[model samples]
Target: DMEIKNTNTIQYRSMVDKLIFLTNIRLDIAFVVPYVSKFMQTPQQTHLWAMKGILQYI
Candidate 1:
């Protein structure tokens, strides 16, 4: 995993939510952000790792 830093759940959800709002207008992060947000419901360590992967992709 990339030790690229981290975020708390509250911050994570907030970020992804904002990204979701952008999805309606912006075409960039639309797809990846929602897919990442899905894990916000129950984010585990592994989920965070996956999210990080998505982040890298974005």
Candidate 2:
């Protein structure tokens, strides 16, 4: 199991926080947002990619 850590956890969390806030207005992402939020404590590259995908989705 080779897990790569996200270099910018702060940025990742910030984005996730914003996504959580957006969930109130964009119900489409409500489900996925929480899914990604699960990795907030120790986000990895894959997690960050998921977040980016969410942004693209919006």
- Candidates' TM-scores? 0.54, 0.83
What's each prediction's clash count?
Answer: 0, 0
Residue 55 error, candidate 1, Å: 8.1
- C-alpha RMSD in Å of predicted model 2 compared with the true structure: 3.6
lDDT (tens digit, per residue) of candidate 2 on 34-58: 7888888888778788889889879
Which candidate number has the best TM-score?
Answer: 2
Off by over 4 Å in 2: 1-7
Write candidate 1's Cα lDDT for 1-58 as tens digits. 2333334565567767767786787787776876787877656677666656655665
Instruction: State in Å the error of residue 41, model 1.
Output: 2.5
How many clashing residue pairs are found in candidate 1? Answer: 0
The root-mean-square deviation over C-alpha atoms between each candidate and the true structure, in angstroms, is 5.6, 3.6
Query: Model 1 misses residue 17 by how many Å?
Result: 0.8
